[model samples]
Target chain A: MTVARAVTCPSCGGSIEIRAAGYTVTLACRHCGSVLDVAHEDVRLITAYKRASANFAIELGSRGTLLDIEWEAIGALERRSPGAIWQEYLLFNPYAGYRWLVLADGEWQFGTLLLDRPEGSLSSVKWRGQTYTLDDSSEIETTIVLGEFYWRVARGDSVQCKTFARGSSYLSSEASGTEVTWTQLVPIDRRDVEGPFVVRQRYKPRPDLRAIREGYSTAPGMDENDLPMMFLVALGALFIIGILQNLLSGPSQCVSNRFDVVVGAADTTHKIGTIDVKRPWQFVTIKADTDKFDNRWVDLDYSLVDRRTQQSIDAYGIVEYYAGTDSDGPWTEGSHHGETLFARVPRGSYDVYVDAGSHGWPSDPRPDTLDPKNPWSAPSTVSVWLAACTGGYSWGMFWTFAVLLFGVPCLILWWRHQD
Target chain B: MSKRLILFSLWSLFLIAISGIATWYAWSPFADDERPTSSAFRGPTHK
Candidate 1:
């Protein structure tokens, strides 16, 4: 059983109990809040502070069972870095000696003092075959001190601390004057520590409002610039515009015809049909679909000849499909249906003509087994259906606008996650 | 809205307006303006 020694504060004459007795170096007067040096026989006054005792989440001198060991919160230090403030509770068990429970940003870390120092510099360190990389470095100042400590800790005590992290585990080194101390801290779930320590206030995860809107909660360096949100709105607007443009592009006039050609045949120009372009400028869509044929391809070059001017606007398309069994099993390449878009063709009466040809793979292929009239037999003659439509919407422009509208915000979000 | 968001919204609105006007005239910066030369049909083995 551990015995506590009661002493009188030299400054305030208030009774203060040293929980650790011989091991405790300093004790703060509970009555007048004065720091007293208890290492010597006579409890000497270090600093006379006449202030009200600060409230703690876990009251000092309270005994709690943690890690199956009964430990008492003997000392508490409130420290502040540049961006954050945290509370450190010094716990003591006569057999287990000393431990630190750090509460920062509503997260608890159970810290154990290192008996053997970690090897290497501040940037990286090796401990027990595990490598830890530098996470952060900051100068911490003790803002408030209470109860008893094993060291001569006073208010305004400062130390430069460097923390290296391996996953969720952290190795921290604090330097003050010529002395440096290392501590290994591992995250302890709030549920595990709160009940054991009799913590009053519970920790709740705060949600970022912007993150909920932007669909990412863990993105670092997120600010209220609203670039991402604006991009989303722009993308949404563009999508609506694309849908409207597609719906309201006006009634289309289309001309279509089918031509049967033999494999490895030269290009032959055929007059399909005529379509009238009544708009000032409109997109022209050229589409081709062919009956499925193995190891063969059909290529078509289209021309829209303006009957008034005798000038032509041209486009090209192909319908090719190949499938065969290889060493890696069945493989297929290319598509049987292809569409090519021509944008902003001027209004005119035009005769649609297509220069068509059919070729085989390996530059030479088997004779045409499919009859020109049959058209559905495989591995032979290919029947190509060519169609031209006026007043078609430019999906190319829509997609280009879509990428530009949405890509910037996505890139920024990606960069933030990378950081 | 924040000032930056308002400014960005205005800029996006301007872009949408431009796109609307351009689409009304069937004019697109990404349009294939080059006259059809060779076959645009790129086969699997076309160089």
Candidate 2:
């Protein structure tokens, strides 16, 4: 995390000052329209903003076509791009570790993944010398009833390669017919991810790792290990698709399921989180993106609670990482497009820190979903109908016809070898 | 046939199993008073 700058408000261009000691916040000037974010924890009063720096760095990377560069470091990325670079330093905490990032063209939009960890997170026995890098190119997802979600990098190319974890799970409500090809399910909260540990990619030195060239990989046909696996996948794909097709789109009714909500206390100024429901909906999920809001504000401030109860409810916001994966759709489009977080808690808290720079009731709970109109869509009804009537699976039949129908038959017709 | 046909075949097999169990409950011989019979159907003939 970069050292936060606590200076007089530049908008109204006046001297509005804030000096709270925990969790950084944004405070805006009622005059001149200037905005600033205060990193109360660092209190350095520095001039360099991390987001700007990241942008500049990313621009350099893109300009230089640094795809092969071991994606690491802020300044290094800045040097590679020929154009402008944008950088940002988001929230931080000792237990949840901290985040320092440099993105190419966010234009003032990013995500504040509202997940928390336990005490001594950096010093935990399992994290003394562990290494991790950003899982770039990984898909981020959000949806109407489902928001703030991500897919862990499973086997990158092979089917069933998505490392499905976190509570931002989903159920398919599409692709329910004989002509359909795919379906997805709601991810279950990985009860096993329950350590106060940070999630990072195993880091390697930029000079040592191979550069990224191919966007993805071509199927190596099906090796012995791969064929049996792919076959099982094909069949599981057929059956699981059948089952999920039933859950959200077919006939089964699932009762409201349960999930784990992890909320840890805060000590650093960069760590102010609360428990409160921002948007209340019935039988519908939600996701809130906090990126553009960060840019709209001019200043940040921090306020502490005397542990008082206001509004008769808990004076805090409980944020959940909405897991919206379209595993069952033609494509997991909106759900996996970006980072989203959902929290509908009451206002009862210990400390309330906010970047009050962007002020206003958040623009009418615009959640990230596939279709803005039909945001709460389930798995593909299209595929459900397909499986109910078709004999072999979609892909199963396609591949069988692909090789047997064409390849093998062609070889027989063209039998004579040149030799 | 398609994969759905195979699935239907498997489901039909399951249904057959279920019906077999249902028939056992309905037709297997039982202890005297428990059994439904022709005398019962006739409502007890006069002597």
Which is the leading candidate under DockQ?
1
Over the stretch A303-377, how does candidate 1's per-residue lDDT look in tens digits?
889999999887766678777776778878888898877777787899988888888775646465556777776
User: In model 1, which regions exceed 4 Å deviation?
Assistant: A1-232, A366-379, A411-418, B28-47
Per-residue alpha-carbon lDDT of candidate 1 for residues B1-47, written as tens digits (9 for 90 to 100): 67756766666676676667666667766554354544443345522
On TM-score, the candidate that comes out on top is 1
The regions of model 2 sitting more than 4 angstroms off are: A1-16, A19-419, B1-8, B19-47
Per-candidate TM-score, chain A: 0.45, 0.15
Q: What is the C-alpha lDDT profile of model 2 across A1-419, one tens digit per residue? A: 34443454421113444544244466554432334555454223233334333223222122110112222221221211223333332323334432233232322222233232111222221112332221111222211010011222111111211111123321111121232111122321222111121212221113322332221122222111232333343454444434432232211111111121111111122223332221121011111223222101111222323256533211111111122225554321121111111112222333333212221122212233256567676421100000001011122222332343233323422332211
lDDT top scorer? 1
